[model samples]
Target: MLLQSPTQTVMSLEAPNPLSLHIIHLLMLIKPATSGGRFRVLRTAVSFFYMDPTLMSLRSLQLPSVNTGFGGSADTRTKDLPALQSALLQLTQAGILTDEDSNGNGLNIMPVTCVRAAMLIRCNTLLRGHSGVCLELVQALLLLLRKGMTPIVPLRGSISASGDLIPLSYLAGMLEGNPDIRVRTSTSFVLSADKALELAGSEPITLGPKEDLGLVNGTAPSATLGCLAVHEANKILLLAQGLVAMSCEALLGKAENYHPFISSVCPRPGQVECSATILHFLEGSSLVQSLKEEDKFKPVELNSASDNPIIDIKSGEVYSGANFISSSVANGMEKSRLALQMVGKLLFSLSSELINPTLNRGLPPNVVADDPSLSFTTKLIDISMAAYLSELGYLANPVTPHVQSAEMHNQSINSLALISGRYTLQAADVVAQMCVAHLFAVCQALDLRVIHMTYLKALRTKLVSKVLPFLNGFDDQVAEGIYERLHETIVKSWNASACFDLQERCKIPSKETIPVLRDHLEEHEMHFVSTRPLQRDLENLAYPTFTQTRSEFFVKPPTKQFLGRASLGLYCFVREELGVHFHQGLVEHPGRKTSGKVNGRKKRTIGSWVSIIFTALTNDQVWGHLVEALGSRTCQVRLV
Candidate 1:
């Protein structure tokens, strides 16, 4: 006879959210038995016990209804009372009851000792559905969470089309309150799946075949990482633009190239808009105004277009096409580097002028160096460092082609959208670091006495103390060594995630930083026309003093309709080739004409063909390459 608790026995089944608790137990039971894997069953059970119950138990578990009367009995299928009784009887036989007590008060005869083992069996089941090996899945899940923020594993890493099995498994283990796992600890949290349902009284996350596909098919993780990098680079670009403009102002650089007329002449949206914005930033500066007599700065701007991919949500189709390619961003980045290079060279000029006793504007040579022996050497070294950094920035321009030719056919190509963004970011990052280095040198030359007037004096003082301590004028060797050390610090800070942080700190209110420059050219100073002016009109047209020219001649307009073959072929072959060789002076000329008679009059008949004819061109390599690229095609043509 089963014995009751010697003292007292009470059966109390009521619990808060009883439905949820029941679902938890039910899931725990069926999950292991149905998944049919020893490892999976155990892992799932472990996770269930450890995971937050609220996140797990709120969803109702539905079990299929089946008849167990050992016959095709309609009545048995209707009720199946005997099956229910038999199950309860088995539970009693297993010592889950105290013989129902003398007064019919149900209670356990003895406390259960192996509860952990029972719970673990279920955790294993849920873990099994993820991958074949439950133990490894559990281990990987734990490791993933420990990796810190954004533990959501990039779903692209999984080869499973069944679902986001890897991430789903981790999420399951997390929700189930698995003891073997750890979550980010916080004082307050609102989030769970199951308990969340009961609180709002809603259904669980439903899954259908299409729904499953939607859940796991996209490469959001890869895209997110790429986009985040792009976002960050864009921010740095913004700041760099500001810094470049500031440098331009301080050095008395021209702002006319950014005017509307200059930018509109090219008709590139990014080029025009950016130039206008930058010019606006430099408005009303004293230093720029004073330098008007010296021809120190000239207006400069670049046009850029960004290409990315877009998903058509309304059509429910993924149209993989180039939206914005960063060729423009690259061009702009390169031009910005050029602009900065010019600025650095000018800074050196200004610094040298300050040091020469005859040219010094009441300031000592090398700014702070009082001794004649050290001043020039020290100043020159610092100037060279800045120039070197600027050169590095200019050289950092990514040379990757926007479209690559297919090995089998020149007509096919793939858009390196992510690659483009990545390169742009890398280039921008390097350029920004260079700017920081240049800024550091400039602040140092201004010296300690200028601190009260300049807001960056504090940063300059700290950087000097930490990296380069001032002394007597420096010779070339000492100067190069100092610059090298400074560059190293910039690199170290960047790799350590400190440079971005420090830059954020330096961007304070403008009122605190001393005004160093001005903006003379406004955006309205630019304009655009469809056709370039006639040779004679080019001289007559009123344009900015810093006007530059770009010319393009096309024999025919390209078809606007989306021809996949043409898209693949033209882009891979001509589009890219044209961008490179167009400015190199290659002329796309119509083919030769034949003398013939038409009607009663003598007429010249054109072959109606096209070919690339380079002026004064000696290279047959390009022609050979084009022939190989085009294969044996003889119909409609493109020549670059």
Candidate 2:
């Protein structure tokens, strides 16, 4: 009956909704707290309406949580009606839930669709606590979503068996009907396979287990990583080429060293190609054109390589071996490191060029010669920072062998190619950051000088605006100190600064920046020349085991005989200025006289050759005059 009392009477407005009525009955029995705690009663009323159905269904069927409480494994039994009701009431009263209508039923809800969706959300949230394959899967799913492709059901067995399983599964779930899967989706719910075909007037894909597995599994993480590594390595190679060109220009190196005629003479592909690239990179500009031939390449010690693993899907076997090893990439990385080091040193010289009052090219020290208090020290600091960062990158280059054994008995542990892939990615990022810093320093130095071309000025302005925006003026130390942090952030900027500047400065419209940089590298003798054809040799070379038990297993490559037939495989061209030097000896004049003659004379020649005809038959200079004489004469000498 409708009552007229001091309190409100709650009743069901609809007949089919028993849960709503149950909620109304509870609200009527529990009055709003008199102590201004009205929010609590309202919460209980809402909670009861949502949980009532699940509770009532269980009560009618009789669930275990009612008699023994909510304590049971998956085997014990389903939840009880009373306990479920109590938990829901407590949650609602605390304002931890909301009322949502679905299928004409009042249910307690959060922001997601189903239980799996909630778990996916939790999985991503838990990423802050852990990493590796799970994180990689999430990232891949994110990528797939960006491209508007949906993944199907994920299998537990497939991830352990294949490299891309987990990631694909995560991606598929996110793309499916469950909105809570929370992958970046363009629209809510995937219309279901049936509806999609009808709407589009096309047959629906009835995907099987094998097809689904094929879609998600079989990804070459290591290979792709290697591919990405190669891509990044290419960039570093370009930057290294640029550094070489700058050095060539600074040292006044000759262009003939990079001539196609010279590269054609030697058939080794990498050498010829590298030489060609360097030459192309430095095609124009007054600096490179002015250099003489014999002024390139400085001697140093370095070595590097990249490795990957392979799998045979048909045989259900993972033959962990190298499909491709990046010896060329590693070598390039090391060489670039050394080349950039020298470039950094040359950059330091620019500070001296501007600082010395007598040698100044009309520019002041610190490039701020107008300000007496600010000295070249500020500019020198930038150079030092570049050098330090270059060293950091140099340290990253190493001969890393691919390890493929097994991860757990399930084989899931060892297939983790993301380890190497992520590392290479990070290293490449570091290299890019270092190059940008160096570029910033160069721009600063150039800004103080007379900019010859409009393109150069324009490029310089653009580069400054994006790469070094914080350097608003000359009086900002905070901006300078943050350069390292900026580099660590892995920012990338592709502009016409390099291209336009080189073209306008060199007056060569047909040439590109990469080619010019390569040409300049050859001019400076920083380019490595090989005697054998690179691709041919690579074809004959045996793929190394991606996973080896012992390091010595690689002592003799399986395809050595096959590779040997390729002819003059890898050879280095050493320039004269970069020749080896020795610094250990004593010299005396022939002034000592004995018995009216210079009997105790010690005349040591710096350039004379003394050949010891035993064992190695090595040569040494005994006297100063002979060595000095040898130094004066120019000869093409080869030693084995």
Candidate 3:
């Protein structure tokens, strides 16, 4: 007995099967059309109730000889009934759903990237509502995102002219519950076709007449990858601008190049926008000079758009165009790469000035505060920066020019947008590393200058605030006294002992003295006095520590890990040891509230903090240690 209510109904059949239950549920879910007459109502009802697996085979055998727009030779093949059933059956029998055979050239793409691409395509189609895809197909796509199902899809082999046929077939195959297709579960485990369907609580959807063609007939995958690349490149541009401002500050470069008037003269929108952004970041910065300097600034710009054949629902017209061409995106990424390269060169030049005594105002050669002979890391830093610049140069090559023709004369032209996007990501990561190196050098130079130049105390305070919580109370009088004692001792030893004359004297004698000198000077050589142990007061008084050689100071060579740890140590040392309030920002500014939350606290994006940190780390002496750690291999800056 079947029970029927005003708004709900229970089905009672001879045998209550899953297919019948699904059909009844779907029927209840379908709403009545307001304007479509009997034919429209009938069509809507048929679309909902006809999605039974049992009916699929029988329906395929009885497909009416109807000629649809789909260009297959047989009318049956072009019809929705047989086409959907045949496509599903073909996927179930075949292990892989790629375009090529055994000898065909194809590339395997990441399962996640493929799934994301399919999701984007499905969303676009649904938003337009012109594709003849049934409600069942839409539900399946929604289910895919809700359950986070990722299916393996091929990268290469799609000529992209007949849409993304080869790659999209895998997407269709996964929805059809083909056991051969692999799916990635939310837990990051790879599951067989059946298991994935079961876990998702989704049934295999029966593709309508033109659904399979609709799924495969678009340039969704390439567009998705290109879009993602564009997004990442945009972020890189933001970070790169910040780095440029920091480099300018570290190098004591003039800010007039980034002035509004300079950009107004040329009137290039991209250049004007970049100039404004850089100038905004440099606002209130004492390090940047206001004088009009030579033109040395380059701006970053990015452009992104979708390239897919769109359908008009009102006109019922399918407009096929070469919108899938990604040449514009590829060119934009190349331009971004070039902009990053320019920033790298700026960092390199600033680093050169920081390490060279002649260039860095009056700082020690190589910015080595402790021992010049022991830790000459200037060459190492230069080589690393140069290597990173070289890689950026190589990545800046235009990918649009590399397009090739393939796929049986049908796919006469292609776009390598995905490849270009991947390269752009790699370039951005390398730029981050280069910025980190430049920051370390800048911080070191500032620290050395602060000891002697009182005029730079305010700048030093701002730079130190990022890494250190409070500035350590460095006594100039005490430091000067120590410098005089060390000078007198060195002179006396040179006159009294013959061997002392052969030993090279310390460069730039100041209140700062090497820790080894406090004990006793023996014939121009430092000797530890066994009479008393090293005191904490004496150690704290030493403004900067100096060593004779790399081996004397560092027990082990610095690695990337060592550099990271060392940079972190500087941050910790300032907060814990100095007992000063450490503001991560170079200048004290009010925090701006952001939508993001971290650990239940409202997050804020601090631009000044970013600039301060970049400047401090690049200008800091810690890079000397990183340089020594890298040794001769510093020139090998390969992207991982």
The numbered model that scores best in lDDT is: 3
- lDDT (Cα atoms) of all candidates against the true structure: 0.29, 0.30, 0.46
lDDT of 1 by residue, 419-534 (tens): 33334434444444443333333332222112212222233333333322231244557545554454343323222321122223122221111111001011122232222222
lDDT of 3 by residue, 1-640 (tens): 0111111111122223322211222111111111111100111211111122244344444322122322232343443455644553364233343543211223445436435544544433433343445555656665665566767665555444444456666677778887767776666676666678888888886665445655655555555544444443444444455556655654466778788888788986667766766665555555568644302111111111122233444444444455545554456556666766776676677677677656554455665544455445345666777898889889888776776765444456666655665677567667766765655555454444333233223222322332121112335564444445554543333222211111232221211223324432433343334312222322222222222222222332221121122232332333223321222121122343433433233333333333444444433433343333223432221111
TM-score of every candidate: 0.30, 0.34, 0.55
TM-score of 2: 0.34
Q: Model 2: how far is 44 from its true place, Å?
A: 63
Number of the top-ranking candidate, with TM-score as the measure = 3
Query: lDDT of model 2 at residue 346?
Result: 45
TM-score winner between 2 and 3, please give it: 3
